[model samples]
Target: MAFIQIIEGRTSRFDEMQALTEEFRERSEGASTVRRGIETRDRDDPNRFMVLVFFDSYESAMENSNRPETDEFSQKMMELVDGPPTFHNLDVLKDETS
Candidate 1:
């Protein structure tokens, strides 16, 4: 099944968080497990941010989560937020084309 991870974080450190996310994007370019990701900011609350990450499968996501690079990325993410980020794992049910 296709998996989606919805991550939410505080917006106080948007710039720093964006930089960290960009770094991860650059490092994960050639990674086969990570399919794609999008970063979004809350329209009402500027201090709120969310990241939608898609992986080929749950197993692939787990594998990518365990990589050393991911650990480093996690560390960087922690530094830019007030509290721990939230992650919601979901199984995609439908697509617009379908």
Candidate 2:
């Protein structure tokens, strides 16, 4: 089954984080197991952001942590964010295509 990894947190430096997010998008394009990703900010809390990453499977999603590009992004994100980012892994129950 497919899986999704949700990473959410508050960033003191939104601009820097945004720049890193842009890089993440470009770098992740080549991740063989990644299907897609969605990045969003809370409307009520602009500083809080969430990134939803979809992968082929749980193992694939976990592999992302070991990716050099992902590692680099993580390092920068940790520096710009407040405290540690929270990750929620979900099993994709129903994914439909039109």
Give lDDT per model, in order: 0.85, 0.86
User: Top model by lDDT, which number?
Assistant: 2
User: Candidate 1's residue-wise lDDT over 1-98, tens digit each?
Assistant: 88888898885879888888888878878874878888899899999989998987889889999988898999888988989988899988875673
Q: Model 1, poorest ten-residue lDDT window?
A: 89-98
For model 1, what is the error of residue 98's alpha carbon versus the real structure, in angstroms, after optimal superposition? 7.8
Model 2 ranges off by over 4 Å: none
RMSD of each: 1.4, 1.8
lDDT of 1: 0.85
Candidate 1: give the clashing pairs: 11-47
Model 2's lDDT to the true fold? 0.86
Badly placed stretches (over 4 Å) of model 1 are none
Clash count, predicted structure 1: 1
Candidate 2 lowest-lDDT run of ten: 25-34
